[model samples]
Target: MEFKEVVGRRRSIRFFEPDKPVEREKIQVILETARLASCAVNAHWLRAIVVDRDKIPPDKLNQLKTPVAALTLDLAPVHIYFFCDLGVVKRIKGSRLRELVDAGALAPTHGWSHKFVDEFVYPQILEPMTNNLQGYLAAAMADCGGAAQNALLAAFDEGLGACLNTPNPVLTKQVFDVPDDWVSLWVMLVGYPAESWEAGGQRPRPPFEELYYEGDINTPFKRDPGVVEKLKASKMITAPAPLPGRRQEILQLAERLNLPM
Candidate 1:
């Protein structure tokens, strides 16, 4: 599938064909894409548990879901639990910078050594993340989001439906035999689509002019109309008009779910 189409069609798929199984090989490929996601200095402090519907006991799977996630998890063919591997930050040089050095992007004489990482990076970055719990949690969530999005796009490329979600963190962690440091981040529900794969028409977004800054906070930056038009024409960018009744439909669904509108 085209990259633009993949972006457009990538919706938070809720309904899935429960009985349909996503192949293990396909899951491996999606995970490879996830491994390639950018993170903090390529610390690679992340891992995942790819749970199949039939493999886990029903009671345990139920524990992983909250009120918001139950419907989605109930029907998903697979549930991928993304988490932070606290030990990665303990490494003197994380996987990424070493790989960069090996690729000749860094001169051996120019960059700091693993000893420097031990002396400085740990004291300045990793230590604070632990001593300051909020910082640690925020970094974990952001890192997992980056990795999960890569997997989601890869799943889309494989013609499978995937959705990113946050389940009840405590319950989810309990279900898996995670270490004290292996903190739960979020989940990605995967399977064959049970509904239309279309984007449900273009969704609403903040006005483009309001989204970005020109220099500082005061001035809003607008994209050049000619460039924007060209991108739209090539199907690389789209901002379709909203369909009528969409907001009301959303409100109804929220009401059904007992969620604040």
Candidate 2:
């Protein structure tokens, strides 16, 4: 699809053909797209559970309806749980390590090495109580968000419709039996859109001038008229190009994930 068309068509698809099954291969394709999403210093910490009948909680599944709308979860062919893992940041080189080791600041040692891990890092990270809880949570949340958006757009590219939502986090934790260390960030329903009534036209977006900034938020950036016109005229609404090797990387990752039985 053209970029503009994809943008115009990519709506928060709520109504779907409930009976139809979204193929495993297609779902794989969407996930592959998400795998390519950008991250902060490649702190890849998001984990997703593509739940079908067996793993999904019965009671929670029964209550998955919105107030006025139809049962959104039941309508889709598949439901996905997006989770944020707190450990990824701990494994990577992040700001916390930098702050501790920078020359001016209180340094952990001469350099960040395995020796440092044995002396300073091991005692600090191994003890569950001593971890940087807040810092880890913040990094994990950001990583999860990037992965979520990747999944959403990948669905769009696959000619599938999807709705992303935040389910009751507490209930989700209990129902899915998620570990205390991992948090449920959100859920997304995926399937082909039902051909029914129009979901009132595409929602509004603040004119680019309002939302975007130049060097800072204080100064509104002016996009070139020709460039804007070209974008507006040609294709779907897209962000910038993702980093190279994203799709390939994600496909390799899918092999490691637990797919529905």
Candidate 3:
């Protein structure tokens, strides 16, 4: 599929084919594409754990209610958890001197030690500016979003359905044996979508004039009608999916997708 259609057609598909299983390699490809996303300090702050339908014990899946309102934990066959690797920032900071030298930013001829960064540079300059515990994890949350977005796109491209989920961190930790240092951010539910992958003609977006700004914050940018038409024709922008019937279908399936009481 064209990248434009892939993005435009992507939906938070909650209903998946219950009998179908996702290929192991497809999950890997989606994750690998996600890991390439850029983040703070080149630290690669995100790490992921892929849990197939079988990996997580049945009792563990039962502990989830919504994870987010309306998300059914067991509906999708695969769950990919995007988490903060707490040690990433420190690892990046510790390797700073060596990386700088290798990149030719600093000369090996310069008298630099861990003490230089540890005592002088880090304390006065780097420490205040760089990762503190609260700040580091906070930044990681932002970093993980990019990686997650990549995963979404990758899953769509691979003809899989996926949704981002907020699972209960406490229950998740118990289920996955998550390390104390790792933060459970969000999970991606991946599997075969039950409905049409085509746009459902329901795009809940603000008007472009309301969404985009001009030279000043107070001013809205007026988009040209011709340009908008051109974009629509090119699949660069999607029209609302064919409607009327679409909403009911989504609602009905959404109800069915919910876990049994």
Candidate 4:
């Protein structure tokens, strides 16, 4: 699919074909895409634990599900638990940055060098950030969000359905044997969709002007209707959600799956 179409088609798929297993290669592709996402300081804070739902003992799986995500957790064949490793910056100590310098990605023209990293970046900047744990976590988690979004987009591109869910963090840590330094983020529940790919239609968002600004706080970025039309033609802007027969579709799905109406 074209990139615009892929972006347009992405939906937080809630009902999945529980019995259908996602292919190993597709899962690897998702992870690979996430691995290639941009990160600050080359720290690469994002980490994931991929779990096969069928392989998990039923009791443990139950423990992992939160009140809101129980149905989603049960329906998805694969659960990818994402994390931001807080210790990565401290452990690597700017070695990854030095690697970028050595490879010329971080050029001398940008004032990047191993000596610069060791002297100024690590000791002065990175170390102090690490000392302020709350600030450090916020920054690292933002990087993880980018990587997670890549994984989500990859799932759609691979003809799969996925949703980001809040897992039971305490149970997740215990069941997955997560590292002490790792902070739990969302669990991406993935599988083949039981419903149509459109799932109704594109979900709603705030008005574009309300969300963005031009130069000043008072100046809203005026949206161009011509560009909007071009995007709509390219399928980037699609029909809004609660599409016709959406309720009937949900009812049928519920009846077929023996779920509450």
Candidate 5:
């Protein structure tokens, strides 16, 4: 599918085919896409543990589910838990940045060199930031979020359904044997959708003008109708949610799945 179409079609698919299984290759593609995402300082803090639904012990799986995501966890065939390693910056100590300099990606024209990293970047910048745990965690998590989004998009591009959910952190760590320095981010539940691909059409969002600004904070960016039309034509902008028969569809699905309406 076209990139725009893939973006358009992405939905937080909560209802998945419980009996179906996702292919290993598709899962690998999602991970590969995430690995290629841009990271600050090339620290590459993101890590993931993919769990097969059927293989997980039932009791442990139950413990891993959060109250809001209980049904989602039970239904998805695969669960990918994301984390950000807080120790990465301290461990690498700007070696990754030096590698970029050596490879010419971080060029001398940009004032990048091995000496620059060791002297100014590491001791002066990175070390101090790492010492302040809260500030350091926020930056690392932001980088992890980018990588997770890439994985999410890849899932849709591979013709699978996925949703980002908060897992039970205490149980997640215990069940997965997570490292002490690894902070939990999110769990992506993956499978084939039980509902229609449109998922009742595109979800709602705040008005574009309210969300963006131009040169001044008071000046809202003027949205061009022509560009909007172009995006709609390319399937990037789709119909709003709660399509016709949506309620009936949900009712039927509830009955079939033995879920309360």
Candidate 6:
């Protein structure tokens, strides 16, 4: 499908064919696409777990409560659970630590080593505990969101469907056995579009100008209305076609994941 058509067709599909199983290799490819997503200092905090319907327990799925998340998690052939590793920040110490130590902060005679450990190392350890969990969460969320979006688009390119759904991190962590420091961010449900309706009754997105601004909230640019309409018609803007080699990379990812597909 063209990017425009894929974007136009992309919808938060809650209903799915319970009997159909998503290809294992396809799921691997999508995750591979997500893995390539960019992150600050190459700290790829996001860890995605692709689970099939049978793997998700009934009571656990019910725990989601919301219709969207429940159906998405329950009915979809595959679910990718996004997680963030807070410990990844420790990798920042390698080159940075050498620079800090060489800069005289670790001078043994002045007891700067003690000061360095106390001032920097201790603070790095305590920061997460003292600071707002929500703040750190938001940053991790933004990091995963890009990767999830990439995954969704990749699915569309592969002639599959996917929807980003909300899931309780508390429940997900327990169900998936993710470490305490590694928190659940969200869930992406993937499958073939099995609904009878075309595009699953999707509505038009809000006008681009109304939502986007130039510099501040007040300052607005005269967006090219025609461009949006054109893209909307083409489905390119909504579902951007994968770049060259993206699909191939996803296929290779299947090998790494060892998924059945």
lDDT scores of the candidates, listed in order: 0.76, 0.66, 0.73, 0.93, 0.93, 0.67
What tens digits encode model 3's per-residue C-alpha lDDT throughout 102-157? 57755547766556655665466544645466775667788888899989999988
Candidate 1, 175-255: lDDT as tens digits = 897888887877899998765565345666788888899889888897799987776776656556355565665566556
- Candidate 2 per-residue C-alpha lDDT over 1-261 given as tens digits, one digit per residue, 9 for 90 to 100: 654666655777766766677889988987786777766534566778787633456677865544533256766778888888666555654544444444444343445644564565555654342276776677668777878887887787778898888877676777778778778777788888763212344556778889889999899989688886677567544333243554554454334332221
Candidate 3: residue 216 lDDT (0-100): 88
Instruction: Point out where model 1 deviates above 4 Å.
Output: 91-103, 108-110, 122-129, 238-261
Determine which window of 10 residues in candidate 1 has minimal summed lDDT: 90-99
Stretches > 4 Å off in candidate 5:
none
Clashing pairs in 2: 3-235, 3-236, 4-235, 4-236
| lDDT computed for candidate 2 | 0.66
Off by over 4 Å in 3: 67-71, 94-134, 247-261
lDDT measured at residue 130 in model 3 versus the true structure, 0 to 100: 51
The model with the greater TM-score, 4 or 6, is: 4
lDDT of 1: 0.76
lDDT for each residue of candidate 4 in 88-118, tens digit (9 for 90 to 100): 9889999999999998999999898999999
lDDT of 3 at 206: 83
Tens digits of per-residue lDDT for model 6, 4-40: 6766666665556656888888888898989888654
Q: Using alpha carbons, what is the TM-score of model 2?
A: 0.69
lDDT for each residue of candidate 5 in 87-201, tens digit (9 for 90 to 100): 8898999999999998889999999999999999999999999989999998998999999999999999999999999887777888889889888889999999989989999
Give one clash count per candidate, in the order shown: 0, 4, 5, 0, 0, 10
Q: Residue 71 in candidate 5 has what lDDT?
A: 92
Give the higher-TM-score candidate: 3 or 6. Answer: 3
